[model samples]
Target: MPNLLDIELLRTFLTITETGSFTRAAEEVHRTQSAVSMQMKKLEEMIGRPLFERGARSVTLTPDGFRLLDYAQRIVSLSEEAAAVFSEPELQGQVTLGVPDDYADRLLPRVLQAFARSHPHVELVVRCEGSSSLGERIEKGELDLAIVTKCDVGEGEVIRREALNFVGAREHATHLADPLPLAAGPQTCSWRRSAQHALESVGRKYRVAYTSSSAAPLISAVLAGLAITILPESAVRPEMRVLTERDGYPALPPCDIGFLRARHARSAIHDALAHHIVTRIGNLSPAVLADAAE
Candidate 1:
């Protein structure tokens, strides 16, 4: 039999091609730059061609590189599809789930509790992080499923898209001078962008009064009157008030929260969990569903 090409090396090659830098690809794959280079070298030797043109400051794919990339992507995608179809067993084992911090606190607990009550034998492992981080973990196969906000779809199944709304403390003064102070999350957060766009569309200037990756601090800042924040209605607690809608602030376009799974994951439990989330949380806003249909 001929020497078989390594799937891992192909994956590394694809990552390098997509990111356009070996250093960034190494960071993404959690390998050293030298290790990534070695993988590329091994792949080139196997294929009997140099795939990339190495320059002093930059690297670009050669003509051969483009051809190999097409094949590599197809191979990886087919491999994942095959794995998903053939490897998945009946639901009876653990399922690792990732959820955004706000969702975990406000909406997920009930869904999880219900799932636990029904499927006591299946262990559920939950990871809480920002939506972007959650999506990254799911893509890397570190997580089975994730609930995220407005992630670039790229090429994957989108399980659901929930609507997000602007929220604020009911007691805070509705009126503010130019450049409204906005409480926000890290730059990667989808809601942060929505808040900024909402303000800008209405000809309102804004400044970031506070920034945190975690949900607790962001909520605290809102409660303390430091600044207003935008969140999904499902994430809003009973105590929080709708300052924007009440004060006649123009409504922001609804944020789309989505659930995603690895294309290659082999677990019936993942399917079941995804079905549960989409049916339950996805249906929370009839208005959103109607709008999407329209």
Candidate 2:
């Protein structure tokens, strides 16, 4: 008989991909790092192809691994759906969620739609704030759940990895200015801090021509060629273009979108909402979202 792909192994594979490292994936799957490594070896042996390209500190999917990911995700999702139909309850409660302004437009709608379909009785109270503020609220037990952009490897299930890009209006020569014009949020924002740090590292002279806590005006400033700003590639507007090293911008570090659940009593409703958020984030457009775990 042909060796079958175990559901548990597939789950492990998805976890590893989503978390970017075996160590993190093991924590989520309740396995030791060596055990996770052994599982990957077994899966690769059964499939007759290596699944991940191992790095000293991180791992990336191989081409064959990427191909298998789609089927694995579908299989896992269908399995969950089947189980939920029989084992899950009709969850009902008000769940408070917080998201950063930059991600609100990109990730919020899908999460809302998924929750609406899966647990219609659950009411979603969402707060839009900077990631730093959201993290603080989650820590203070003021929220049921929050999706936050972490500057470092943060707590909770890792969903998506975001590469910060320097973006501005298309055909805009604002970057050519001696003291580059920039539009950014307050210093508390990771985007602004990373942008400034990158510029200062290279000894580049820059000026914050526009600042806004909201996404609307920041995008407007970039579109109007008033300044360039650091943003995740997914958040870039249609009229905006990413400025690269050749375009006189420095590379920035990658960040992640992770969730934090309050350390209080949980409900089936909360779990359902969290699941929906993860699924939606995993389904983001591949072109813009690169190096994500799931």
Candidate 3:
């Protein structure tokens, strides 16, 4: 008999590769650096091959690591799919889920597809709104579950923490404008505030060249080279370029993603969906995994 690869280990492996830093991946997965290293050692032992060429500051994948990456990604995704498929087969109810526009495209599909496949009888009522609005909705007992941003010190259970960065079109010099042209959201948006604060801290003059409540349009504005905007590092697209300190863009605070559940009631369906959201989104995202494989 052969050793079957562990999905959990594979997930951790993916995290290490995605971050390229054991310490960083450990923090991402809420584990100690030593623990993460041990896990990787275990994975390497199972494969009978070294996975990483460990350097002082970062780690690069070995050829075997690259080969395992493809398998790990598929195995982890399929494992999630399998879990979702077999989860709460008897539960039948409705769950109203609220998500902000930014994460709808990046994070929703897995939840939607898995929930739909796993619990077909349960209706997942999804609402697209800003995090502030979503938080208000949860408090008002209008939403059963919500993925919202946590800007303040402490409030909700944070599921994901992502790097916030200044992003512009790949070929654009919009960031170099005299009063740097910025494409951002309304005053209430956390990301917008982060960008503003980062710029203000450095006394960088900037003007709002474009404003949109939705992330999709703001992304469009950046792609068109109209302006630069703040985005999650993982969410940056191929057409976009991250503006670093060399480009005079100050680093913004990391974005915190929190999950909310309505106080109205707690049913089996609600708990199941909530668990699903936390598990899927709490870990390194599929986007990071794809980038690692690339």
> What would the per-residue lDDT of candidate 2 be over residues 50-99, giving only the tens digit for each residue?
87776554456788888888788878876886677567778777989988
Candidate with maximal lDDT: 3
Q: Is candidate 1 or candidate 2 better by lDDT?
A: 2
Model 1 per-residue lDDT at 176: 59
lDDT of each: 0.70, 0.79, 0.80
Tell me, by TM-score, which candidate is best: 2
Clashes (backbone N, CA, C under 3 Å), per candidate, total 0, 3, 0
Off by over 4 Å in 2: 1-61, 82-87, 152-157, 282-294
Q: Candidate 1 — which residues are off by over 4 angstroms? A: 1-91, 152-163, 174-178, 245-248, 284-294
lDDT of 1 at 48: 90
Lowest-scoring 10 consecutive residues by lDDT in candidate 2? 285-294
lDDT string for model 3 (105-196, tens) is 88888778766776788888899988888888888999988888777324678878899899999887787888988898898777888888
**Candidate 1 to truth, TM:** 0.60
TM-score of candidate 2 relative to the true fold: 0.74
**lDDT, candidate 1, 125-185, per-residue tens:** 9998877777778778898887777553343444445556666676675235356777788
Model 2 scores a C-alpha lDDT of: 0.79
